[model samples]
Target: MSFFAGIKAKWNAKMDKVLKIGDFDKQLTEIIADGVVTNNELETIKRLIQEYGLTEKDLNIVGVKAFRAAFKAMMSDNIITQQEESDLLAIKDILCVQNELVTKEMAVLLEHQELRNIQNGILPVIETGGILLQRDEQVHFLLDCSLREERVVRRSYQGGSQGVSVRVAKGVSFRVGQHKGRMVSERDVVVVDTGNLAVTNKRIMFLGSQKSFDVIYKQLIGYQVYSNGLDVHTSTGKTRQIIFDNKQFKADVLQLILDRVTIQ
Candidate 1:
């Protein structure tokens, strides 16, 4: 068996034992590592077959250079984000433990991205191209070339009391109304029996300062204000309100949202 095949064989056996013991977190971590290994191995196999005209015999010759070149291409094309690169490098560390050819220095270099280390470094160019995966105090970024900030505006229809929602991206939709869009504004209000309404915490926190706004709005639920020529209040600490004023930005966000929301 090849190195990966051998690893899989052992992994499967270990999985059986772990399942019996029910070490879920450990098992999940192993599964994620295995998935990365499988994906990389499949990619390597595809390249070898299409370009080098090699067979199974060449698996032993697979080196870090091939992986590095493929990864570099993906980065240039914006296929994978920096966090993904870090995950792949972590997988490589595990792989290196099994193979003597994979070196420590190379793994470190692969894991590190100077551009990602500094905030606002890559934002100006690809602001709407990524997702910030929150983990503890650190942020893990992932890019979705299919969606952009200008194309993810949140919209609330004129006559709806069902709260606001974001427009969906083309070819990407989850449920009936779970489309990913930008936050515009939110407010808190009290409904009385005499057809009177009291509005509070009206606030607008654009996409750029979303995290900070979310933090502050969670505590300012009683204040009210105007947003996009409409009156509203920041009533809920759970949901975010977003709006886009720029014509082109609104147009793009609406088109992408409609593309995802239209009934098939």
Candidate 2:
């Protein structure tokens, strides 16, 4: 190929990529125009992300914009209803937004839902994950946060020294040695795993990378709310701390649980 032809071809490709970005943004804006995304629209979003002209980074940029726009549209009224919340979640998942990336805004949305629920004596009903829900069980958001569990670890320390052995008799010898260190219990706060933390009308469920469990509202004996997380105690004498990036989210979850526990 001629040098000029090669240069022109490369330029055309670059221009096409830029054009694809504009097209992707326009499509996304339209999809989220009504503040909701339909199941059929998912394919369109996915196709745009996978467009051959754009790079992975470019797709993500477009997707993030759409994701944020969806959030704003749905919550424009300062409230995200059950269906709108589902739609928002769908957009997030399709856009591949990690839980940590969404901590702040999602926390705010949950707070909105919780406050609204209080006014009407309603619990935010949501689709449950993995664990089978019992009768009357309704789940809220599946939070992406750190789960902390207490565990016992043994550490050894030197307590004594060894002495030289000497021959005391023809057939016997005397030897001296130092004693071993004593074992002591030490408590530490560590992150066991990270994953979705869902609160329900009856329980607090966590599905994590290395750990998963549930604490029922009835079994929830007490909880201490912190700026970044929560320490919950269950009737079974188990204590777990769930950590979030935002203080407001911690308060929101605590408040929602407090309200739910009263009537459960």
The number of the candidate with the highest lDDT is: 2
How far in Å is the alpha carbon of 157 misplaced in model 1?
Answer: 79
Poorly placed runs, candidate 1 (over 4 Å) = 1-60, 78-80, 94-112, 120-264
Cα lDDT tens digits, model 2, 122-174, are 65566654768889777765557898877665555656557668899898987
Clashing pairs in 2: none
Which lDDT tens digits does candidate 1 get at residues 194-239? 1111111222222232222323223344322222212223455343
Q: Model 2 shows how many backbone clashes?
A: 0
Q: Candidate 2 regions off by >4 Å?
A: 1-116, 128-131, 152-154, 164-177, 184-187, 246-250
> How many backbone clashes does every candidate have?
23, 0
Q: Give the TM-score of candidate 1.
A: 0.19
Candidate 2 lDDT (Cα, 0 to 1): 0.75
Give the Cα lDDT of each candidate. Answer: 0.35, 0.75
Q: Estimate each model's TM-score.
A: 0.19, 0.49
